[model samples]
Target: MNNNIKRTLTTTILAAAFTVQAGENNFDQAYNSVSEADLRSHVKTLASDEFEGRQPTTIGEEKTLDYLTRQFTALGYQPGNNGSFLQPVELVRIEADPNVTLQIGDDSFEYKQNMVIGTSREQESVSLKDSELVFVGYGVNAPEYGWNDYAGVDVKGKTAVILVNDPGFANPDSGKFQGKTMTYYGRWTYKYEEASRQGAAGALIIHETAPASYGWSVVANSWSGPQYHLVTANGNKDRVAVEGWLSVEAAQTVFQKAGLDFEKLKEQAKNGPTAKAMSVKASVTVKSSLKRSKSNNFIATLPGSKAPDEHIIYTGHWDHLGKDPSKKGDNIYNGAHDNATGTASLISMAKAFASLKQRPARSVSFLIVTAEEQGLLGSKYYAEHPVYPLNKTVANLNLDAMNILGRTKDVAVVGFGKSELETYLTKAAKRQGRIITQEDRPEAGYYYRSDHFSFAKKGVPALYAEGGAESADEESAKYRKKMKVILNGCYHQVCDEYRDSWDFGGIIEDTQMFFEVGYDLANSDDWPKWNKTSEFQRPE
Candidate 1:
């Protein structure tokens, strides 16, 4: 081998040997070294009244990005994007018309209670003039599964109303669908995109608090305010004419009036194929207002010694609800658990990675993405416009929220079986004398909710690491019950704030574990591939 080739080979083999020994390092000591007090200090500061909840396109954005940039610099990480830490993700913000109305043959859809609607188009007003409507089952067009909800249908200029959740539930015992695991078919975004592909003028997904696993209020609270989308030419024209959700009750009423059985269709949609799409034998119309705005994504990197071209990434979002001074007691949606915790912990991780005695073989990029609360906009932009190639990029370790119920004896990964990342995670946890927990509610579609989904969609293996289901010193039964109750209650509410008495012990455990997941990947040559069953994994 030439000297250069021989040198590269030497480095690769040395990295392999070092990783074997590094894997056995004291993971618990690393976990303990992460200061919970320091982490909470950052969280408290970001979620504090001074930052005004860190909303995008406001002074809060300035403060949030400034603090994050300072943290990464203090941690000794080099700037990630061309010697700068911030990647400006241009977005068009849309605020719905309070007087918005959807009418289908004299029947007006209820706002807030029935459905939430908005447009990303750059127009003062938008309307759907005499477009027909159809029910396209779950609205999924996955070819690998031999399923097409749009079979035998010309939905162009027509609205396709799809059912929510996975087809597995449609035919419970048929073994066609995933039974309980919510496939990508269940996501609302999928319904809209499928409709767009079908050239549909509009797409409406039926939402139930149960199958959706979150209350209608969660949908309302998120959609009521501002919605952000990547700024693209043709005004994101490839997207559907419009996208919205209908409440379960509203959908039942409309389906019944149209001589269709809402319950039966829902069940049928869950099964393989519904054969025919819901016929638009009816017409519908809607009118709305739109807004344009801008946001920013914060980024930093721990440079590698040998392979700077290859990368490993750690991601979190910095934006939240901002100051909703309209509410009483606490008008600010501080987003303590929603993401401030995740962002703060990332700051901790960047520091830990920077402090290592040895530089990694691959570059470690620490990214604080923007507008995740608005629907993973910033990370989506980064994936589309990455500083590094997605293929050479080994893995993405994404954090949004960390459980603050103190330290647990276990760690929970949302999509545990979907990729080889889990094996490395299991090893890391075992090294810390902790265990890994699979998703507690796989049927609810937790895996597809965060910014990680964007990376997953791009065929880059990613992990959504969070607290384990089991609590320390608590009985399994009590832990399960308590866990379920808490997730349901505080999922997306004003109540998701900083708590003084929180035992950040669990947060530290998870952060340290997350640190190693990236550390090991950054130091090694092998890249984790998606599992065989995972739909996102591209064919060989």
Candidate 2:
């Protein structure tokens, strides 16, 4: 069937389903089953120092799996993965040697200072020796947009130094590549992937704070530790030999050494210019220590009374940055706001679903995944090796970083207008006297950063929404300011630990809304769909 016909049929079915109303008292009981006290208890336990930051392949993962299993079993949910609650995800951990230097001509840059380098290839040593450096505009080869940075350049054995973000970011007024709202092409992951496809030996992204959305410290801390990737037969040998980032200061030095004007070249890139040879050779060696391990994605299901095959999936990642023992004083990266809150919200929602006297027509499942901090590994694995067929899966509702900063008058729908799932979110929010709003910082690409992206990439209609900036009561400006301070200071740091001062009212409200959204999806016979203009679409 054509896409338009399928969409029309689905819309008609959905409209008819909405005409009949389920008992309000039954839904009220389930919605009220989600409690702030339950959310707080789970967050306190998961984000505790005793969990060792919930790192995969550690004792932390074991504790987490055990806790989730016990909770689901108590809530009367059956194991979702066949008869087992756990789905094993094979992963390889590669920790690159930090005592290395990147040499660009006569100038050298220190690792974790001006440069952060690593390799996904499971090898003892990988090197790029005397490799010529080519400046590939945005390092984007997007044919759909009539832009190709590597149009004339053959970087087979050379290193490509690319700019961060896309050309649209540099010239937002040009109406190119979504114009400041970053597409998937703007991501550092995309740059590296494109470079590898062009057969580059190495790729380095020139980072700017405004474009990358985080400071150099984040790059240093995040890339310095052991990196994890899903195990492949070839051990990710298809990827570039070396992948890394260059601080703006280091990039400037390299540009000066090459006798090229960096600022002028950036302007030309915005107009779709081809790659430029920097006339500078680069050398770097990455010595890695590899470990192969297995992690589990916890899945529990409440089978429907009618259409048990069709499913509604709720996902929340349970992994964090783990602990850094090298740091002085407190070193644990207890990711309370980063994910522990999301993880807790999942357990709370599961309880609410289980409390429903008459189950929804479609099955509802809770998927608490591992290694999300390591680039959404668990969710990616599940999306690829799904226990329930992707075609049968109705929708994915992801909860990541729940709101703990009091009640809000609005909900922020990240990557809004992508899917029909937002219609359900809008209806649920209206019940709470709240409105749906777009995320404050769309350029940051919060949508692509979460577990839902894994499912969305495979054509699943996914929704990721949370509390917005507007306060429910009087302190609107003050609330916004305070939230900014708290989120900014604590993101990916040791300061992300749970606090007694947190207000769980917002978390409770958001969780309740999530419960309603999922319940609606579970009961409805119609499938949600991606918008026509969205890059993602259900496959024919």
Q: Name the candidate that leads on lDDT.
A: 2
The regions of model 2 sitting more than 4 angstroms off are 1-20
Candidate 1 regions with alpha-carbon error over 4 angstroms:
1-20, 23-31, 275-291, 325-329, 475-488, 538-540
Residue 2: error of model 2 in Å?
A: 22
* CA-lDDT, candidates in order: 0.76, 0.89
Residues 283-347 of candidate 2 have per-residue lDDT tens digits of 98899999999999999999998999999999999998887877899988889998999999999
Positional deviation of 66 in candidate 1, in angstroms?
0.8
Per-residue lDDT tens digits for candidate 1, residues 490-525, read: 656777777775667777878888887787787778
* Alpha-carbon shift of residue 88 in model 1 (angstroms): 1.0
Which clashing pairs does model 1 show? 133-280, 135-278, 167-270, 168-177, 170-270, 170-271, 406-503, 406-506, 407-506
Q: Give me the overall lDDT of model 2.
A: 0.89
The candidate maximizing TM-score is: 2
